[model samples]
Target chain A: MAEPILQVRGLSTYFFADEGVVRAVDGASFDLYPGRTLGIVGESGCGKSVTARSILRIVERPGRIVGGEILLRRHSGQVVDLVTLPSDGSAMRQIRGGEIGLVFQEPMSSLSAFHTVGVQLIEAIRLHSPLSKKAARARAIELLALVGIPRPAHRIDAYSFELSGGLRQRVMVALALAAEPHVLIADEPTTALDVTTQAQILELIARLQRERDLAVILITHDMGVIAEMADDVVVMYLGREVEKGPVDAIFHAPRHPYTQSLLRSIPSVLAEPRARLATISGSIPHPLARPAGCPFHPRCPDAMPGRCDADVPVEVSFADNHVTACHLYTEPVA
Target chain B: MTTPVLEVPVLEVRGLRKHFPIRQGLLGRVTGQIRAVDDVSFSIAHGETLSLVGESGCGKTTTSRCILRAIAPTSGKILFRDEHGDAIDVAGLDRKGLRPLRRRMQMIFQDPFSSLNPRMTIAEIIGEPLLVQGMRDTRERETRVADLLRLVRLPAAYLNRFPHAFSGGQRQRIGIARALALNPSLIVADEPVSALDVSVQAQIVNLMLDLQDQLGLTYLFVAHDLSVVKHVSHRVAVMYAGRIVETAPTKQLFTSPKHPYTEALLSAVPVPDPRRRAHRIVLEGDVADPSNPPPGCHFHPRCKYATEQCRTEVPALTEIEPGHAVSCLRAAELSLRGVASGS
Candidate 1:
């Protein structure tokens, strides 16, 4: 494999609320090669979105990236430390939407309802690419077409409200691809969409990745989408990486108890009707009251006596492609 | 199966329609009606679970609301029969006549937190509904409320606390208790578990199933989640553009969905398996506007196998197999997503 376009090491983000300090994203590490789709799958409070946002330095105030290295390789073969770069640096400016684009979950919230989608797309394009209005509009239509929006020419003038959820999402995708970024961060892109629309969007993203060699980071809780689009999977629990591996390995032989429990909890489409789905008992532990030792031990079915209850388990490599942070898997497997 | 709990259907709906007038004038002149629910028809057999599954804005909620008479239907009949075999056409009832029927048919909303009145204590919120129907006397109401709390698996001690004091799953349990306060024969739960965590969702779903068995209650479950719907529903209705495109027994629909829309929906659902690969029938576009649906088949625009016949004529729900009804011109030839074409 070629050198990774982006490398994140030991990234940690936290928020200080009135209650206490909430360790949102703690020590998340991953590498993103061009054209590879990496999936971050976790429940609501797992900090998957925060990790994505931290990469862009969009972590809002009260929340701060206390530690980590975000390294980016420029087109000119320039290696830059993204975290250390000045907020107002010219290079960082070029990279924000130019090199790393984002497609948010809610199009209505991200898109301006009052403005026509044509205007928003054109503006996004112009911000990154120094193009005239007519050229940008043309490019917007082309990009919209790339995302499988039909009748792009006339539909570009339609307001966000006038367009359907799938079309608006396509428009968002067009905006994200405006600069033809090296990496795209899509946070729950299909969670709000219906199943049919979700499938189309996922297929479209995969097709685009193959065609353009765009590094995509898909953050979602849906395991199905991960199986469809992800090359690698990263499972987070209580703001930490509980498991990481190839999609097949993670799905088939999940090492962490949390990952195993999560997989078991989902009602399979192919499962017999009479069989009850294996549900992980108890809710996601609150950020403030996150249990001592392994964050998942409270809900883990195979939690050992002292190992899983006292000390935080270090991420141990189980295979060439798989890594898990569970005490039970600490010993070498026969 | 199990002697068909109530023998008579708890709620029977036929060609229900709800059209919101699109007016544009000081005088509020009616220009055209937005057909939120065009022509929906279904029945909830006694102690049966019938789920209305659809995407957002497909009028599943509207159809459920109309059944509860929370919102009046513009046309068609909603025959709701009580346990004593007393039938009432809810559509024809005025406020005075409908008051008594409210006890027979209760609704459970989507968001448990918002569905519950935050100002009131859990005890008050659950007991108020029963109290409204003249079940006064604080002592008796408290006892009944405590029992209801226990029924949903929440401790009776937590009854004095406000809704905000509990977690999302607990709040939903409280919402369930409040809905069951009237001991309604039929309950319309609109996306009851969608807002919960996945694990929490499973527990709540199991709780609902257990409650059904214990109470011998009928549930009109409405949700977009097909897996949960399949797990809970005895019969399933697939709605598209404010109309039911398909209706069948749960097993039959999952095994051999006849309609293209139903097939597309089922295929779109991601199977949580790494070994099995699914060729999902991805629809080309989003759901069309309910206000102005397509001329003929509302789904034709997005449907892949839509022919000219599908474009010009609206298909009626016809029985293609035993207990299976589908609305599609080409139901005979189409291959469904998850299920085999023939059963």
Candidate 2:
């Protein structure tokens, strides 16, 4: 395997609210190799998005990274720990878009409504590189065209609101690629898109990854997407990663009960018509009231009586890089 | 479970059209019309689920809204069968005439978060329909609410709790309980589980199927997720640019679709199995704008097998097989690939 472009270890992000500290992303560890896509799959409130934000050091106020190490291999062949750098400092700012780009779920919310798509693109371009306005505008048009936006010259002048959902997302991709970053973090990029549109966007991302040899972190709640795009998979329940392995291993021989149940629960196109989908027992617990021991113990069908409810499970490794955090594979501690 | 009688449809719609006139200039003159629902027609038998599947702005929701008379259609007949087995023209009904019929048809909204009122208790939310129907006694309403809650598998003990206390899946169940309060024969669920998580969505889908079996209800399920649609629907109508391009039994639609758009849609859905990563037919352009669609077939602009005739002449939806319909000029010649069998 090639060298990993980014390595995240023991990442824990928490939101300090009046009620309690909400562990949005707790001890999520993963490695992102160049030219390979790592999919972070989980349901809503599972903290996949928070993990991505933590990596970029852009987690909003009242929410901060309590513990983590985001190690990024820079273009100069020097590895730097992103966590130690001040989030607003020049070094972190340079790494944000210059080294790693981000595409958010809601394009309309992420984009500036007042500015034209070209204006935003141009600003992003100039911020990373010392370019004149005309040069930046030209690069912006090129970026839009690269992302498969039709008639980039004309569409560039349109406001974000004027564009359709699919086109708006294309512009967002264009903006993400404005700085020509080596890594792309797409947070539920196609969740808001139609199926056909989603196919187009996914294809675009795949093509761009191949072209740039970019390491990609694709976060989504859809297992189908993870199966389709990811080279490796990380399944999170609540805030913690319950399983991580090669995509095929995770899908074909899932270890964690949460991952297995999630795969079985989603209705598949291949499944027989009207077949009853196997469902997980309960909904995700509230962030403040997260269950002790294993986060998925409450919903796990294979949960052991007192073991799964009393003590946290340790990571158990298997062949083919498959790792699962479940009491089923671990010995009971004295 | 009793088999749905195919002879008498619970609700039938014919040539439904909903056009929102685009006004422009100082005088607010009618310049153009967005044909949100254009000449759409389908029928749902008792205890059957017929899903309207499409992208956003494809008019699936508009069709459902028109069927419920929540929004008036510009033209066409919404024939809803009454308890007497008489097909009532809901489109032609006046306010007084529609009041009683409203109890026979109810709508479930997409977003559970906003569909429910935060101020109202679960009991009040579910019993609102009973109260409106002149169930004067609070005790009677309470009992009925408890029964409805049990039907959706929620505990009757949580009746006093507000919507804020429940999770999204629980809230959706509450919404379903409210929709079933009137004991409507037809339920128009507009993207009901699309807002829910995968695990929770399956639970709701199963609940809906179970409820359908138990109550002998007909569902006009509107959703964009083909997987969920396939799970719950007996038949499906594929919509594009305010029109149904194809309609078929769920199994047939998945195994052997006749329409190019349907084939593309089926192929585009990402299969959960990594081993089945087949080539997806990427549609070239965006969905056609309803206000100014193409000259003939709305999907022709992006279709891979589009011919000259497809671009020039409008193709009427024609039945290719029994219960399978397609609206393409070369429907006979085109052997479109559906999702591979054994998915």
Question: Top lDDT: which candidate number?
Answer: 2
Model 1: DockQ vs. true structure: 0.50
Which pairs of residues collide in model 2?
none
Where does the lowest 10-residue lDDT sum fall in candidate 1 chain B? B334-343
| Residues A1-334 of candidate 1: C-alpha lDDT, one tens digit per residue | 9899999999999999999999999899999889899999998789999999888888897998899999988777787888897666787788888999899999888999889999998988998889999999999899888889889898998999988888888888888989889899999999888878888888888888999999999999888788878888999998999999988999888888889888877755555442356788777878988889999888889988788899999988876679998888777764
Using Cα atoms, each model's DockQ against the true complex is 0.50, 0.72
TM-score, each model?
Answer: 0.96, 0.98
Highest DockQ against the true fold, candidate: 2
- Candidate 1: residue pairs that collide: none
lDDT of 1 at A112: 96
Q: What residue runs in model 2 are displaced by over 4 Å at the alpha carbon?
A: A331-334, B1-3
Name the 10 consecutive residues with the lowest summed lDDT in model 2 chain B: B1-10
Question: Which residue runs of candidate 1 sit more than 4 Å off their true CA positions?
Answer: A332-334, B1-6, B25-27, B333-337, B340-343
